[model samples]
Target: MSDYKLGLDYALDQDRKDELKSYRNQFHIPKDKQGDAWIYMTGNSLGLQPKQTKAYVNQELNDWANLGVEGHFEAKNPWLAYHEFLTESMAKVVGAKPIEVVVMNTLTANLHFMMVSFYKPTKTRYKILIESDAFPSDKYAVESQLRHHGFDDKEGVVLWKPRPGEELLNYDDLETILETQGDEIALIMIGGVNYYTGQYFDLKRITQLGHKQGCNVGFDCAHGAGNVALNLHDSGADFAVWCTYKYLNSGPGSLAGCFVHERHAYRKDLNRFTGWWSHNKQTRFNMRGEFDQLPGAEGWQLSNPPILSMAAIKASLDLFNEVGMDKLINKSKKLTGYFEYLLKQLGEDTIRIITPKRSEERGCQLSIQVKNADKSLHNKLTEVGIISDWREPDVIRCAPVPLYNSFEDVYRLVEKLKGILK
Candidate 1:
């Protein structure tokens, strides 16, 4: 295969012949000082916005301006329960039933809400199990949860880490931890795709292990939601939370989505933080007696959401609806695989791909472990208008989003990196 040439020109030729080339024009690709479109490869952090976003948002803005308070019902796309509009498409993207998913709140907030209900710790089993390399927010959230429940995080929090001298996490370690601390472990919450290493854990296997040990299971799918296929329903996780700003192509800090296994759909006895929005819609205005909670994920809402953010989410989700997630993901596997192939050409000693080689283990983002490189190298790439991201001390992350990125874009990125390295 190395004998065959796969270079920038070859990839661009592929782009020239692509069926989805037209979709690239639909997005507002960011530009540089010279007014050239910057190769945006950081969709793992923040996605590019669709040009139609303005029009979709404008429709709601116009409705709000004219209809005033009456816009709740009178508007073209009524504001009363505007979030419901994005549910079906969002569900389809993540492989969930319409009733099992809801788009609301930010990612971290949804995590806390899900934990409150699902992380039911008994006297004997009160520990929270997570990956050693979980995102900072997740580490903070679980630590705080342990404190809230009168447990010391130092003792109650268990991190399933890889064995000494190994870069990748070992599932055997997780099994070993559960075997030893099963009684003390009340919850197993992991990042479906680790942000730093780009490792996508086996959700079904993890969930099964947690369930066998009598622990509630959930996933913080910030990196997994848009990139990989998270069949949340079949995985049998108690719940999962993800943001739209990344792969979902919703704007920054856009309203997040959550999943509640259909099995827990109507467990009225479950504890949850409730607000007026969580109340029954028909009887909400009455506000007379009992707190009637809406069933499933909607019941988790703490307030009526800011409509503008939801508008952005609706805009992006509508695009997903038009194209369908299956089609996008199928295209994604091929596009991202091509990216992986090119990066490996740089030679293993020069750079290492931390993301899994299998299409099943990753989405679009590839975490490149650049050897003997640091922040300065990242700055050089940025100076040239390549918009990839560097996390902490090393590892440059680049994601060629399927909705907007062309194969030519990935080809150009490799070419740029080669020039920079030279």
Candidate 2:
């Protein structure tokens, strides 16, 4: 299939030819007791640490130890303005303007903060819409918002579900939901990439559809951010939120990124939850002055962020800046395509891929359904040092992350799956 050969030699040859091969060396791949690197395919869950992350994080630790209070203004990166250093590169990764992006609170926190400003409910338009299979955290966040606004969570939530027996969602189904309940919906919050199916939605199309129906649109891009070129600004969504730990390669529980479209940058009339960090930097220290909101996405900040976490983010963004999303995405397509090619060779009856076959409609992840298999298959994979994620009922999710995972890794993964199934 597609001229792909089944052998370790072919995987090695492809790795040798890969332009981004050097990037793999930059990460600290986990090793077994025998000193072999585990075939890690869970970058969608948590990325491996970059080698330079230690030095980056240590810099802040040393600055704090040596400089204390003065480190806020005198550290090498300057804690007071540390987040600004990340703005440009992070913006490039997500395809947003520098003014529209800010690295702030964690994913769910940022989502709640964004909802404060975006989820305005009226008596006539009080419902919210989300995918039926959205990540649990997002569903919780939306449901809580409904309860907070004095609406019955169950009655106020509308699900854009897949057709009967379908694993993937159809845009037409989403359109049908909007056409019938559009007037009653106040917000449309959906995941940019559906986690279980690995289906990447067209953000711009969803935005346009929701806008036509007079509903505010936003996206939880946790699975899409660095794995796919979100083109968030071009998508015209009101707001977006994503964690940096997954594809961004920041450490676990690291600060998340938020995007407020350029159009909303200067809308002072929009209600927001803010604190001292949201005050204009020019007069922020002038304690006697009245509240003056900073323009752009920075206006959403509630407090000064942890410099250590920001350092890790900076370390990761620096790499993204050098490699650029264009080159990374190119390699991702080839790598994931090869994975699909190899899996298909295993036979359609043995396995089924829920992710879209078209490259444009998905990212690095492939959700494979092993026929009549259970978690024991996944457990055996782990026993053999193949680190992957298993979703409930069925489906093993694997991501051939372009930053560090190799073609050989993909090869060995299939080989392991073959053995386990046999």
Candidate 3:
């Protein structure tokens, strides 16, 4: 808000009025040498652990040790239906129905599996369209998909890039690309929220554009899920995938989530790599019946998941379900806006924010481009106990997570940044 005031008292007052302020106490924030909490601004990279995570994980360990094979059906939360427990809560986080959402493989693996079903290519329509600055893993995965299908990786990839000297991607540029080459594009896959720029794309608009041109559409929402309102079901994309490690606050290398629009939930004809987990629950152990694929996003599974990892995910999802995205996002806008407001006061010529200005156009991240700055500036931020991420060149990515970051955290960050710049 433009009315945001200056100084420490203003920040303290904001935190006092914050309805979600108590949530900060629920997480285990990292500490410096003196045991004081670090100013953690990297939730976009890896989220802080919740205090309840240990208890959640230990319960599963106890079940495994006590019940062994019978834990599948007899445990407190049955291993047989472990992933099912996460489905409804996670669906609410990403705006999908329970049947449309499933916690599955890692980000890129799920992307590859979704591609197998949605990236059908013909001789004339063999190209895939992606944002020019998509996360490196997404670029590599899509390129591998092209080569796997016998197309030249370089030629089969069409990039919807930002204009020269521009940081944010424009819809007009994307429209032009589709108009000129839409007929030859087989799939349109883009990051729901870009990693570097923190620009949250209009998923429904992009999906409509792709579908209008007879192209299959999907999104890698690794950066969007739990950070914003994705509305995946309403977007009408064929599929989407996201990881739990970032804004979801699941542990590092936790299981990822996948979404298949309800329309495609029962499409048995869709090609996918499968294992026993993808078979019908009733006939899965029969060992003599025909292949019976499970319906919905669960149909993409290739193996039974690791219980420890799922336990961690369940711990995080429970918090998400309790707090809800609405409350988190409401706090996020005010927190990030205050950050932006303070950053601008450092002199616009000193640092430039590459992320979108509109709250709806971006998440909590604010990518700051410091003039004449290098990695040393980032190192300085780290030395001062401000945990943030630095991209190559000049941008320093900071996400003041609404879940645990206080308004005081944002104030202290900008104050520290102001000193570093001086």
RMSD of 1: 1.6
Candidate 2 positional error at 293, Å? 0.5
Worst 10 residues of 3 by lDDT: 299-308
Residue pairs in collision within model 2: none
- Cα RMSD of predicted structure 3: 0.7
Q: Give the per-residue lDDT digits (tens) of candidate 2, residues 7-44.
A: 99999999999999999999999999999999999999
lDDT of each residue in 154-186, candidate 1, tens digit only: 788899887786557888888899999888898
Report the number of the highest-lDDT candidate: 2
| 150 Cα displacement, candidate 2 (Å) | 0.6
* Model 3 spans with C-alpha error above 4 angstroms: none
- After TM-score superposition, the amount by which residue 76's alpha carbon in candidate 2 deviates from its true location, in angstroms, is 0.8
Quote each prediction's TM-score: 0.97, 0.99, 0.99
Off by over 4 Å in 1: 1-5
Candidate 2 Cα deviation (angstroms), residue 346: 0.8
